[model samples]
Target: MRNHTALTTFILLGLTQDPQLQIFLFIFLFTTYILSITGNLTIITLTIVDLHLKTPMYFFLQNFSFLEISFTTACVPRFLYSISTGDRTISYNACAIQLFFTDLFGVTEFFLLAIMSYDRYVAICKPLHYMTIMNNKVCQNMILCCWTASLVVIVPPLCLGLNLEFCDTNIIDHFLCDANPILKISCSDTWLIEQMVIGSAVLTFITTLLCVALSYIYIIRTITRFPSAQQKKKAFSTCSSHVIVVSITYGSCIFIYVKPSAKEDMTINKSVSVLISSISPMLNPFIYTLRNKQVKQAFNDTVKKLVFLLKK
Candidate 1:
């Protein structure tokens, strides 16, 4: 029974033990991280620079992009650094820091998705009131409230690790510091913490998901009522990307965290975590922007500006 201070540095087992695979992983993940940053940055830039995108939807889109960037930046860079250097030791404080930001960004994202769904609902179902409902102040307040709520929600379970005495078993069998992996390494009884974390995840998912589902239910019902097929198709087209992103993000989150035990098989869990922390961020920008004519036009406009500047 000792303080966590004595066990300051814990060894991260990372995703693989093979030296050859580690190098290969470094290359793959490094590229993914770069792409994630660039893609998210493009979204933010377009949202900021394009006057046509000055709607509540794009406002929330930019915020979501920022979260994706921050989310991956928190975990992937550290994971890449550890894998590349073959030095997998992380300080207790650093590990805790990573877990905190990961949890923060995750819950915030949940709320943002719900908000995004509601924005779509207002736009489609109550078009006349959309502007009134999602004004700038209203949007800002919603984000602030969600972030604050996330902070409050995580405190009860986060204390589990904050007060832990990690005197034994310094090996974390994952690529980065996360709640489950950190709890697995602790010598203390983690049953309560595990329960709380799982509970929080499930509860949050159900509530926020319900909001999104209801929004969609109303949205779909209203779309079906549209007088013309083309009008209904246009509405669905606008929403399809959001639904895809939400389904992937929410589905992956539930699979990773809804388990009874945090100590799920390391191999599978690490792969899942990589998908969430590394691949998802990169995937989101593409999902939102690939077929988006507005974004393509924005990109072309920006390029022309750059070319014109060089000529000067």
Candidate 2:
């Protein structure tokens, strides 16, 4: 088959074809996206306003919340609109933009978490030098590197997709402009791009995951060496929460992405995608705040001031 001209618009097959479930999906996703935005915003506000959270860890966290808000915004709103309006057609350019930003945010989130893990490790394993190691300028540079690296890592696959031959088949079998779904519609042999995507996914996910894992290994070992049971508990408590959040995020992603097939089962892939794109971002705020005593105290303090101002 000869290569074909580029198509103008692509129809997203969306999450489902079930007319009966469209309204329900719309409401559920709409509520979830709203909550994701609200929760992440609260975290950001508290982190910025409260002096208690003026450390490097929370500095990183503020950026993390901003990233999560971006991650959720990139896909959920468009997906929700598609579900509600029954208009699944997306311009090729729009799809390309979505693919790039979502992947950029997704990749950066992974690296940020890794850097945060190192932050925790330094904070715990070398409390005397946390500030010296993770100073303001250094922290700023680390964050800059994460965003820059995300852009660097996503360019190749995006360029590949942009130059693809669609052969007039413009229906994407997923909600957003996912790589696998886009590849399936292209007339060109996608073997090289597929390999590149897989390589990139594996490289990004696994390397960050290993960094996180290695940091925690040292953290766990150090905490276990503490002389007092109370000290041991406090140390583990800090890192454990991060580990849990990371585990849930990376675990779900590995299940979905690191596979032989782009999507072995659309239903399973979609379910896992929802976990990554919607549930995880929504849950991160709670995961981070509910477990951290400093954040809780900051929240209480912020509330007290607001209430006092209102009464006056």
Candidate 3:
């Protein structure tokens, strides 16, 4: 076994090594980070303050927005700093913490999205029983379950990664200490580690995908039963936004994690990973608010109330 005590830090070969490209990246990602934080916070705030948004859907949305904020915060700030200062090194401890929390939040968000889909499914498909089915108690339990599952699923592998000695190259190819990149740098034979990671990933992917798929199946079937053109249109519109968001998030995740490894695949994989991590947060607010008339109105009302209070 390698001497773990000797290694103090690991270098991160972030998105790009080019100085000029770094400047461009700093500008672009900084903007994205700001927007993601702002948009998600706004959604959470509106959901909390608006009486109309007190329903189960918005309740889950509030949690999703909070998770997005945390997910983005875990990596984007460090990435932006690295790009600007040209410091691509993270302490070993910091990297492990980052890796743990990133996976924790990411996995939590995946389950949260599934929960949201279930909320939508209940609301759209079983409107009469929606309130009875997804009451405050149920909502709280679901959120708790999502968070608990994330922590449980992430902790063991993270502990394993932390225990492994890093005696080889200390430089991670990606911006963050993602499991794949971190495993590559370990001096130990990571075959078992690799298998563990793949197993965990496959399990998560299958479970989340199944939940989303089943929710959509029921949603589609429910929507088809609507006889009126207006009812059909409204149902379709409501479900379409959720479907798109779920598809994009789940599709990109599957592609990046499950594909055959290749040299050329790295660029696209990194790009897609960045897109899913960075851009998806911004999309949640837009998707939830823009697609639903009630949410938009509540958001506007909340903003107006804030403005009026400021004026007062």
Candidate 4:
């Protein structure tokens, strides 16, 4: 076992090692990071200030918006810094901290989405009981559970990763120090730790996915029974947005993490992983607001109010 003091830092290779590509990559990612933050923040502000958006669905959307902010902040800023300063190296402690929070936020988001799905399911399937069931207290509890679950899922791997000896290469191929990427560089026997990480990740992912699937199934069944054409149309519009976000986020995550690590195809795999972490956060708010009539009206109203205030 090596002394803890000996292993102090790790180097992140970032998106590319090519100097020429670095400039272009930096410009592209910086623009993306700014847009993502701006878009998500706008959604959060709109959701909070607009009384019309105080419903259960938008309430969850607010939480999702906040999560997206935290999620991207975990990784994107660092990448930008690396691009600007040409310092892609991350300290071992910083890398571990980044990994922990990335996993924590990512997993929390999965559960949050699951809760939102259930909320929608109730709203559509059991309209009469939606308010009673998804009351403020219940919503708070669900949010608390999402945070708590994220903590539990992240702590064990974080502790284990911290203790391991990284006496070998410190260079991480991916832009971030994700569990799998970091584990690859450890000099210690990481088999058990790897298995534990995989098992924990898969368990949470599958369980949350099952909840989302079941809720949507019930929602679809209920939608089919709606007597009014308008009601059916409304349900489809709302549900389709949720389904799109869910499919993209979960689909990308599962594709990246669940498969066997293809060391030979690191470029494609890393790109896909980065796509999920970076792009998905920005997409959530747009998908929900653009697709829902209520949200669109609320947003337009808010914009008008803002413009009027600014003119004054």
Highest-lDDT candidate: 1
Candidates in order have lDDT scores of 0.88, 0.86, 0.81, 0.82
TM-score of each: 0.96, 0.96, 0.94, 0.95
In candidate 1, what are the lDDT values of residues 103-147, reduced to their tens digit?
999899999999999999999999999899899999999889889
Q: How accurate is candidate 1 locally (lDDT)?
A: 0.88
Off by over 4 Å in 3: 260-265
lDDT of 4: 0.82
Colliding pairs, model 1:
none
When sorted by lDDT, best at the front, the candidate numbers are 1, 2, 4, 3
TM-score: which is higher, 1 or 3? 1
Candidates 2 and 4: which is better by TM-score? 2
Encode model 2's per-residue lDDT on 1-312: one tens digit a residue: 123564778898877788778877888888889889999999999999998899999999999999999998998999988887788999877888898889999999999999999999999899999999999999999999999888888898778777788775888888898888788777777888888888888999988989998998898888888999999988877877688888898899888778775635576777788888888888999988889999999999999999999999
Estimate the TM-score for candidate 4.
0.95
Q: How well is each residue in 268-306 modelled by candidate 4, as lDDT tens digits? A: 778986687678877777787778888889888988998
Better of 1 and 3 by lDDT: 1
Better of 3 and 4 by TM-score: 4
Error of 3 at 142 (Å): 0.5
Question: What TM-score would you give candidate 3 relative to the actual structure?
Answer: 0.94
The regions of model 4 sitting more than 4 angstroms off are: 1-5, 260-265
